[model samples]
Target: METTPTEKKSIKNFFAKLGPGLVTGASDDDPSGIATYSQAGAQFGVKLLWTALLTYPLMVSIQEMCARIGLVTNHGLTGIIKRNYSKPVLYIIVLVSYPSITLNIGADIAGMGAVGNLLLPGIPSFIFSLGFTALLMFGIIFFNYNKIAAILKWLCICLFSYIIIPFLSKTNWGAVLQATIIPSFEISKAYFMALVGILGTTISPYLFFWQTSMEVEEVRQKKLIVDKAVIHGMQTDVKGGMLLTNIVFFFIILTSGTVLFNAGIHNIDTVEEAAKALQPLAGNMAYALFSIGVIGTGLLAIPVLAGASSYMMAEVFDWEEGLDKKFHEAKGFYITIIISLIIGLLIQFLGISPVQALLWSAVLYGITAPVMIAIILHICNNKKIMGTYTNNRISNVLGFATLLLMLAAAIALIWFLLK
Candidate 1:
C-alpha cells in the first residue's frame, strides 16, 4: 500500500511543472469571467460556444509571448513600456486600464461576497465583502510570495466544479459540437458586443502584466538573474494552464446552455440568479458546488487583479514592487494594493448591480484590450528587447492575429456605441 519512489517522483514532477502559467490561467476565470460566460450561455446559448474553441490557441499564444518577454527581459511589461514609450502614451495606458481594473475589483468583491452569503446565509453580502477585503489585504501585505502561491494553487481546484456541472445536466452534445465547430450568429451590434466580452475576459490585458511579472519572479527565485537562463519548460506549463482555463470556460458555457436556456430562462444578471437556476437542471450538488467554486476562485482572482494593477503602477512610478516584498519594504506598492481594494469596496456600495458591473467590466476590457495587445506584440517582437527571444513565425503570426482580432472588436464596439 506504500507509494513507490517513481510515484512520488511523478507527483513531485507534476507539481513542479505548474507555476506561473497555471496560476495565470486559473485567475482568468475569475468572478467577472464567470459572469460573462454565464451571460453568454443564458442569453445566446450554444451559438457562442465556438468562441471558447477559437480563443484557446489565442490565449496560449498571447500569454506565451508575455511570458517569454518576462523570462528574457530584465523588466516587467509596463517597466519596458515606461522606459521606451512616451510619457503621454504611458499616461494614456494607465488611464485606459484604470476603470476596467477598478470596476472589475468591485464586481469581483461583490461576486466573492455573493457566493460567501450563499454558503453562509447568516452573513449579508455587504459585511462579507468588507470582511473579505480586509482578509485579502492582510494576506498580501503580510504573507510572502511563496505562501500566497501555495494558497492560490489549492483554490484553483474549485474551477473544475464547472466541468462537473455540464455532465450532471442533460446535454445535446451533437448540437454543442456543431455550434463549437461552426459559428452560427448574425452580424449585429449585440453579437459584436458579446464577441468583444468573450475576447476581453479570455485574453485580457491585466493577464499580460501578471504573467510577465510572475515569470520574472520565477527567474529571481531560481537565482538565475545573472545566468539569464533561457526558459526551457514554460511553454508546456503555460499551454497546460491555458488548456485548463479554456476547458473551464467551455463547460461553464455548456452548463448554462443546457440548463438555463433550455429551461426558458434566458437572462442571468447576477450570480444568485445563476446559482438558483442551476439547482433543478444540474441538481443541488451542482448548485452548491458552483456556489463554493466562485468564492474560492474569487479569493484566488482578487489578488491577481490587485497585483496586476499594483505591478503596473509600481513599474510606471519606479517604486519598489513585488508580492515578494513586505508592506514596509514596499510602502507605495502595498499602499496601492490597499487603496485599490478600498475603492473596489466603495464601488460595491453604490446603487449598481454587481453582476451587471461584472459584465460591463468585461466590455471595458474589450475596448482596452486591443491597445495593449498591439503594444505587447511590438514589445515581444522587438529584437533589441527580446534578442534571440524574439517571436518566431508562428508566434508572430498568432500574436499579430490576436492584435488584429481585438482591434476589430474594439472598432466594432465603438461603431455600435456611437449609433
Candidate 2:
C-alpha cells in the first residue's frame, strides 16, 4: 500500500492541535469532579445544570488568556508572577495553595483506590490508594512531557463514560432542556454549596497554572514555535476542549438527575455511592461503565494535579522544571511532585474521608479562584508582557465577568459557612 506524505501530514497536523487544553479539560472531570457533579444531580436534579452553561464561556475565555500568557512570554504563570510581583505575594500564593493541592492529590489518589476496590473485591480502598499512589508517581517521574501529554490525550476518552451513562438512563429531556435554557434559582444551603462546587471544579485555579506552564513547555519543545499556531490557534482547540468539558458536565448532572434523583436517592455520599446508585436505575452495565470512568479520569487527572503543583514550586523557586526535563535535570521539580503525592496519601491515613477530602479540596480552591482570575487578567493585559497580543475588548470583558462570578461564589460560600 502506498501512502501519501500529504495524507500523513494532515493526520499529524490534526493531532498536533491538541495539547494542554484537551488534557486540562479532561482532567477537570477527575474523581472529585465526578462526585461533585453526581451529587449535584442526585440532590438537585436538573436544577443546577445551568451552571454548566454559565461557566462554559467564562472558562473558555479564562483558559485562552492563560494559553496566551504562556505562548507570548514563554514563562509559566508563577514565573511571570515572580518576576513582576513581590516575593511576599508569590510565597503567600504558594503557601496557601500547596496544602490544598496536596490534599486534592491525596483525595484523588484515594478515590482512584476506591474505584480499584470497587472493581477488585477483597482489595481495600486504602490498599488500592497506596498502589495507585506509587503508579501515578512513577508516571510523572519517568515520563517526559510529550509522553505524558500523549497518554493523557488518549485517556480523555474515558470521560465519555460519564457522557454515556446519561443515555442509559431515562431523561426528561423537556425539563432538562428548559432547566438548561431558562435558569432556575434555589435559595437554600445545599443549592448554593452545589453551585459553589460546580464553579470551583470547572474554572479551577490550578488549571491556569497548568495551562500556562504547558504552553511554556510547548515553546521550549519547539524553539521556533509560532505564537500564531500555538497561541491564538489554541482558541479553536480550547473552545472545543472546554465545550467537551461542559458537555460532560451537563451529562453527569443529567444522568444522576434522571436516574438517582428521580428514584428519590438524593443522598449520594461518595463516589462509590454514586456508582451504586446508577445500577438500580441504569443497570449493572451502567454501573460498571461509571466505575471505569472513575478510574480512567482519576489516572488522567492525578498527574495534572502533581505536575501543576510541581510546576508552581519549581517556577517560584527558580528551580528547573517541566515534564520535558529529565529527572536529574529537574530533581527539585520531580521531588516536589513526589512530596505532594506522599503528603496527599498521608491525608487518607489521617482518618480523613476521601469524599470529604474531595469536596473540601474544591472549596479551598473555590476560595482562591477569584483572586487567581484577577491576576491572570492583569498579566495578559499588560503590554509589557503581551505587547500586541494583549487580550482584546472581548477577552477582557469575559475574563472580568468570570472574576466577578467567582468572587460572588467565594463570598456566598463564606456567607453560608458563617450562617
Candidate 3:
C-alpha cells in the first residue's frame, strides 16, 4: 500500500512532538530497573514474563492521566494538590514522598558509580559516584532546558544495546516464546519477593511525578499556554511515549528470560550479577553490552530521581522550578537539586550496600505510591480544577485499580517481611 503525503507529514510531526514520553520511558529502565528485571529473569526465568505484558496498560493509563493533569493545569502535581487539598494532606505527601524519592536518588547515584566502575575497572566507585553527581548537578544547573532535553533523548539510545546483545546470545526462541505467552510461576517466598520487585520497578511512583512535571516543562519549552487543545496533544504524546516504554520493557524481560534463565543461574542481586552470569551463555560481548545499557540508564534515572524531588519541594514552597529558567531565576529549584546530589553522594561514603539500599528504596516507594495516587486521582477528578478534562469513567477505573494493586503489594511485602 502506498502512503499518502498527509500521512507522511503526520508521521514527521509525530516524531517532532515526541519528548516527555520518550525520556520518561527511557528512564523507566534505569539501573534499579535493570537490577529488578535481571533478578526476575535469573530467579524465575520466564515464569514472571507475563508481568511486563500485564503492567503495560496500567503504566500507560496512569502516566497518561498524570501527563494530562499537568498539561491541563500547567502546574506540577504538588502545586495542584496543595491548592485543592488541606495543609495536612500536602504536608503528609511532601514528607513521605520527599525522603523516599531522595533516598532513591542516592541509590541511583550509587548504582551509576558502581556500573561505571564495572566499565572502567580500578576506578573507585566513590570517586565515580561523586564525579557523576557533580557533573549532573552542574549540567542541570548551568544548561538550558533545551540542552538538557537533547542530552536525555540522546542518552536513551543506550538502551538499544540490550536489544542487540540478546540476539547475539545462543537463545532458544521456542522456550522464550512459550515463557512469554504462558504466565507460569513457582509458589514460594523468593518468587513472591521477585514479583513485588518487578512490580515496584515497572509501575513506579517517581515516573508519575517526573512525567507530569516534564509535560509542563514541554509546554513551557514550546511556549504553549495551557489550554484544552494543548492538553489533548500532550496526552497523545504521553500515550505514545508510554507505548514505547512498555515495548522496551517487554524486550528486557525477553532478553533476560532467554539468556539468564536458560543458564540455571537463579540468583541475581545486582546488574553486575546478571552481566557476569550471562558471560558463559551470552559470551563476553553480552556482558559488555548489558553493562553499557546499565550505564546509560543509570545516567538517565539519577537526574530524574533528583529532579523529581526538587520539583516536589519547589512546588510545595512556591519557589521557581523548571530547567527552562536560569539559576538566579530558579534559585530554590537549583539548590534543591544540588542538595539532593550532595546528600546522595555522601550516602555512598557510609559503607552501605548499594543494592540493598536500592531494594529498600523500592519498598519505600511502594508504600508511598498509594498515597500519592489517591491524591492524584482525587485532584484530577475535581470538576473545579480539571473542568471537562476530569478523568472519565474508564480512566477512574484504571487509576483506582492501580492504586489498589500498589497498596496490596505494599501490605503483602510487609506481611512477608514480618513472617
Candidate 4:
C-alpha cells in the first residue's frame, strides 16, 4: 500500500496548486449553507442529494471564469465593473451585495457563537460571538495575507467532520447512490424554495467577488505569470476545491437525510439545530463533530463575507487595498472590513436569529445572482477584456446554462414570495 516517490510528488504538487480556489470553495459551505443542505435532507431525505451533483460543474465553471478574469485583468471584479460597466450598474451591484454579505456574516457569526456555547453550556452565545468577531478582526488587521491564507487552508480540514457524520449512523448506501445519480422532484412550493435556496447558496455573488479578488491577490503575492500553465494550475485548484466543496455538501445532506428524516425531525432551521438533533440519534460524537464543523466554517466564511464586501468597496473607490498591506497603508480597506464585522455582529443584537438572517441574505442573493452571473458571463466572453484567454465554447455553454438557471431560480423565488 505504500506510494512510490512519483505518487508522493504528484500529491505534493496537487496540494501546492490549491490556493485561493481551495479557500474560496471551502468557505462556500459556511453555516448558512450547512443549514440549507441540512434542511433539504431533513425534509426530503436523499431525494435532493442530486443537487450536489448538479451544482458541481456549474460551480466550477462559474468560479473558474471568475478566477480567470482576475488573472487576466489583474483587477478585482468590482474594479472591472466600474471601469467597463455603467455607474448605475456598479452601484446596484455594490448596493445589493452589501446587505447580503453583511447578513451572511451576521448569520455565520451567530451560528459559530451558538455552536461554541453548545460546547460550553456556561458561556453566553453573544459573548462567544463578540469574542470570535474580535479575534477575527485582530488577526485580519495584524496578520499578513499569507498568514491568513494559510490559516484558511488549514480550516478547510474541518469540513471533513461532516463527511464522518453519516457513517456514524446507519446509512443505506444503495438509496444514497440512487438519489445522487437519479434526480427526483416534488410539486410543492416548499420544495421549490429549498431548491432555490440550495442554488443561491452554492452559486452566490459574494463568492464570485471573493474568488476574483483572491485570485488577484494570489497573482500579486506569488508574482505568478498568467500563462497557459498558470491558467491550467488555477483550473485544477478550482476543480479540486469545488469538488471538495460538493463532497462536503453531499455528505451533510446525506447525514441529515438518513439520521434526521428517519427520526421524523423534518424542520432544521439552523446549524445549531442540525447539530443538536444529531446528538440523541447519532450519538454525542456526531453532535460534537457537527458543532465543530459549524464553528470552523463560520471562521472560514465570515472573513470571506466581510473581506469580499470590503474588496468591492475598495476597488470601486480606488482605495489602497490588500491583506498584504499594513493597517496604516490601507486604512480605508481595513476599516471597511472592521466596520463590516462590527455591523454584522451588531445585527445579532437586533433580535434576529441566524436562520432569519440567512433567509434575508438568501433573498438578496437571489435577486442579485442572475444579474451578477450575466455580467460575469459577459466579461468572460468579451474578447476585448479577456484578450486571448476568452472562454472557450464549452465554458460559454456551461456559463450560459448557469446564468439561465439562476435567472429562473430568481423568478421562482420572487413568485414564491409574492404568493
Error of 2 at 88 (Å): 1.9
For residues 214-315, could you state the per-residue lDDT of candidate 4 as single tens digits?
999999999988999999999999999999999999999999999999999999998889988999999999999999999899899888999999999999
Q: What's the TM for model 4? A: 0.99
Tens-place lDDT digits, model 3, residues 1-419: 99999999999888777788778888888877787787777776667777866777777778888888888788888888888889998887778777767777777787777777877879987788888888888899999999998999899888888878767866667876776677887778888888887778877777888888998888777878777677667666667767766666666676677777776777777777777777778787878888888878878878888888888899998998998899999999999989888887777678767676776787788887888888788877898888888888888998899888888888878878789
Task: Show the lowest summed lDDT stretch of 10 residues, model 1.
Answer: 223-232
lDDT-best of 3 and 4: 4
What C-alpha lDDT do the candidate models reach, one value each?
0.84, 0.85, 0.80, 0.94
TM-score of 2: 0.95
Give the lDDT ranking, best first: 4, 2, 1, 3
Please say which candidate is ahead in lDDT: 2 or 4: 4
Give the per-residue lDDT digits (tens) of candidate 1, residues 121-145: 8999889899989999999999998
Give the TM-score of each candidate.
0.94, 0.95, 0.94, 0.99
RMSD of each: 2.2, 2.5, 2.0, 0.7
Q: How many clashing pairs in candidate 2?
A: 0
Backbone-clash count (model 1): 0
Return the top candidate by lDDT. 4
For model 2, residues 1-419, the per-residue Cα lDDT tens digits are: 77799999977876678778888888888888888899999999898888888989899999999888888888998899999998887887787677777777877887788878887879998888888888888988888888988999999998898888777767778999999998888889999888988888898888888988888887788774655655655786688788888998898889888899999999876778898778777899899989999888889988988888899999988898889888999999999999988988888889898877876777678776887889899988899988889988999999999999899998987888789
Candidate 4: lDDT over CA atoms? 0.94
Q: Residue 94 of model 3: what lDDT?
A: 76
